[model samples]
Target chain A: MAAEHADSGFNIFPMDQFVIRPLFGNHGMTWYTPTNQALWMGIAIVAVVLLLVIGTRGRALVPSRTQSIAEVFYGFTYKMIEDINGKAGLKYFPVIMTLFTFVVFANILGLLPYSFTVTSQAAVTVFLALAVFLSVTIIGLVKNGPGFLKVFWISSAPLPLRPILAIIEVISYFVRPVSHSIRLMGNMMAGHAVIMVFAGFAGALGIFAVFPVVAIMAVYGLEVIVAFIQAYVFAILTVIYMNDALHPGGH
Target chain B: MASEQLMAGAGQIGEHAEGMPQLDFANYPNQWFWLVVTLLVLYVVISRIALPRIASVLAERQGAIARDIEQAETLKRQAVEAEEAYKKALADARAEAGRIVAEAKADIQKELDIATEAAEAEIAAKSNESELRIAEIRKGALDSIEAVARDTAGEIVKAIMPVAADQKAIDAAVTAKLKG
Candidate 1:
């Protein structure tokens, strides 16, 4: 029965469906289906909300297990903010923590079998990175006026070299969001693709599938760890970006 | 050939010409719809109800730590005061002991002085009494000697010479002998 089905070219696990396709014409880059990505995003959001509600609803001085876990996450983010930007950074706690929790849950959810990895798509990661970039830039400008431009220029070198170095600095500064978004998207996409390839191998190898199956299992576990690490890396980079915006100087 | 075969196998498994059930955001699965609804509810609850309570609890914890530190300071001060009082009491006890020892020594010295004075006075009074008795005995012995001498001379005169016993003679003889 399996040979008959195989001869008919009927694949049990569809891999091509994950491919990006163009939505429209003319400068319309190929992108993942928004529907699938949005569904995953919705799931991630719900997970975060459930965690917050349950964790915060019954807070005791000596916390419940859930509350303690939530507090640890909260404390970790709080410390990260404080360490990166000092006491003044506390004002951005809500946004930073929200972003951290959202991204982390989304990445972790992707590791589940049959779940869509929304963070694997460039569009979603780009949107997040661009949002962070625009907000930090605007905040810097608002806080420091036209002087915020000095963040890419005057802070790096002596006055005589400012004009020449400013061009290079500004170019690099603009590249920040691209690199940030691509880093997360690339890691997640590569990890998921590798896992899919391994899973497919297990199916293709038939009776001699023990090695492939073990390898796929090991890769799946690693993907779970990678998901969390990618989220943390994204959040940490966001903090560093915000710090540069706020400080303007290296100090 | 194998790739084509795999694609065919996948298509047969999927069955639907368009492939695995494509997600439609407009008409999401019931599970996802309910998940969104639950998430919206939770977001409201967290922003409105949960976050404020957590903030207050954190504030309370900070206040508790401050209170504990202040209470510890107060207890430390009280301990210092108690220690000072204890030291003062110990010092007073030592001083009192010294005073008691001094007083005892003085009392002993005073008793010793009085005893010495009383002993000296008794010795002087005994010496005076002994001297007075010696003088009286000496005077009595002298008088007795004179009386005996007078009686012996009178008898001597009566035996040796037949002379009448006259008061003038006897008195002259006693007087001459006493003088000699």
Candidate 2:
């Protein structure tokens, strides 16, 4: 096995896969340039449509196999919002469902060989987090007016401690997007990189590659679980933030 | 030697100045643009199409189940009512049969009483007619015996009497003897 690529030189750059490049011919990257990132995002969109749109086309009372899968995704997201955000937060279910489906699809799809993870990129996750953060903030402001600041006001604390608590709350509030975005991106990138590293070991270990191969299998299984869990975490955190925004007084 | 080569590869990449591509800012816009487009498309498709269809199907199934339960309930009630009606008819028939039996008994008794009375009246009339006939036969037998006795006395007296003496006296004596 080592002799397979021995002539090409012993090179295994795990980070090389993370490099963003144009999907087409080499050129200066532009904001609107269709990159591999865009291509993978497009694939994720297609996956979502196939599940949510085409899968449910029958609208059968007794669902088809694909339709049942589609409904499970729908019901799972619906219940997630309702449980964490409560009935009032149900109004924002579609947007949160979008975030969930996109992240989940990207995470799982990236597990395929030669596929780029859209969520593995900080820029994409940041955009997603910012969208949730911005929309929830504006919704709070518009729905609750000046009262939305109550989320940080900490009225339950002792009068003197209230000011300090409020400051802490405000800082934590602003830091939400940073942690939210990085958490997803870091998990995805770390898992993929570790798997790639193990694969490189398998390549270098030749006939004794069984050790790294087994390790890759174990990590790959763990990565599959992590992929779904990370998506769940992202969606659940979005619900919590939305809950905070919807009912700032409860903070 | 392999380890050395791997170490050199890592060090060379650190000097490449590209670092982690994720930290690179130049590709942000492309990722952001595509991400927003994908999210927007998902939101429209889900809210506009999928959610409502699922909700309607669930509601329809709920309604169908409820209707089926109602129909079954109605059928059960009708069955119960029919059973009650059948029981009532059965009871009525039993009572009707009992009344018919009593009426027949009464009619038979009345006819038996009338026939018994007629037989008794006929028996009484036959006995009265037989008694009248026996009384008339006894009276006739007594009259014959008296006539024979009177004739025998008169013969004896005529032979004995030699004297043609007083027919009037003889007649008076015979009448007086028979009377005595």
Candidate 3:
């Protein structure tokens, strides 16, 4: 492992030191772990809770500026849910809002001087993505009963092509969570690593630092915009999934 | 020999590093546990708290707009009624002025007719009295002239003939002169 670490140009990939290695060996265990990512997750949860608890406690009619901003976020999420799922979708507004806020905060927080980005780790993003996937699948099954299989194959095409298309459709459906998780993790990990390398260059080339510094600044600005966009993309996907579960007309 | 083995191992590692990570669901054991917890918490919060508040706020905003429109309609109706009342009052006032002017003109005409009739009666009475007074003056003058002529004739007869101065004869001559 040490030789592998040395072989890499830099130690950018997470290692066992960054994870909480399980005390005992079990049937399922990994050589790699993500302890820093777990810690960041805890921080994200606390921050989200603190913001929500304080923001919603008073429930004022004529909102203060702070309260009004909170209201706007809540309103935006509600409208998104309504547009995607109609009135029935309103029930999922809080989850979508929380997910959006947490992911965005996690992304932006990683841009801070000494902060670790939890979302950059595959495990963290995979966990969130899988949860959405399972819930949507379960909702579809519960709502449609045996008819849920029609979402994949039986409802669309002729009988001869149904089996062939069903297999492909099923594989794609299973791949949704993997793609969703990897997309976010890969983006965050790549962006952070690039910024780190640029900052390192600025540190190394002390006298002629202007180019590196400007590059870092530009990357930072782009990261901030990406942070917001990733959150929106995640939330919008969740709404689309909910829509699929509710009304499976290939939307 | 050890140096050669190490170099070969390094080459193999470099080659393996380029390949993507294997799909190892077993290695990622905590995935299921975290997924369950996150989903449960999110579902509970969404169903219980967040959605209801948002819906109620939207409903309230819609209600307020409807109420404002209703109030505006009522106010417009009241304004129209007030305008109609003002126009009606102005029309009544104009009609009253016209009636009063016509009545005054009729009263002045009646008074002028009565005054003209009274002046004409007074002038007719004064003219009749003047005519009666003139007739009396003329009769008196005639009587005085007749008496003077008779006295002059009697004096002339007495101077001419003493015998003729008898009372019966002088009386007969005077009577004849007066007659002629």
Best by lDDT: 2
Model 2, residue A126: distance off in Å is 0.9
Ranking by TM-score: 2, 1, 3
Per-residue lDDT of model 1, residues B26-131, tens digit only? 2223323333443455446545655566677677778888999999999999999999999999999999999999999999999999999999999999999999
True contacts kept of each: 0.10, 0.66, 0.12
Measured by TM-score, the strongest candidate is 2
Report the lDDT of model 1 for residue A233. 94
lDDT tens digits by residue: candidate 3, A143-172:
888777777875657789989988988898
How well does candidate 3 reproduce the true complex, by DockQ? 0.10
Cα deviation in Å at residue B5, candidate 2? 29
The list of candidate 1 runs beyond 4 A from truth reads A1-36, A159-161, A204-208, A249-251, B1-51, B127-180
Model 1 docking tier (incorrect/acceptable/medium/high) = incorrect
What DockQ do you compute for every candidate structure? 0.10, 0.27, 0.10
> On a 0 to 100 scale, what is the lDDT of residue A132 in model 1?
86
Indicate the worst ten consecutive residues by lDDT in candidate 2 chain B: B9-18
Please identify which of the two predictions, 1 or 3, would achieve the higher lDDT against the true structure: 1
TM-score winner between 2 and 3, please give it. 2
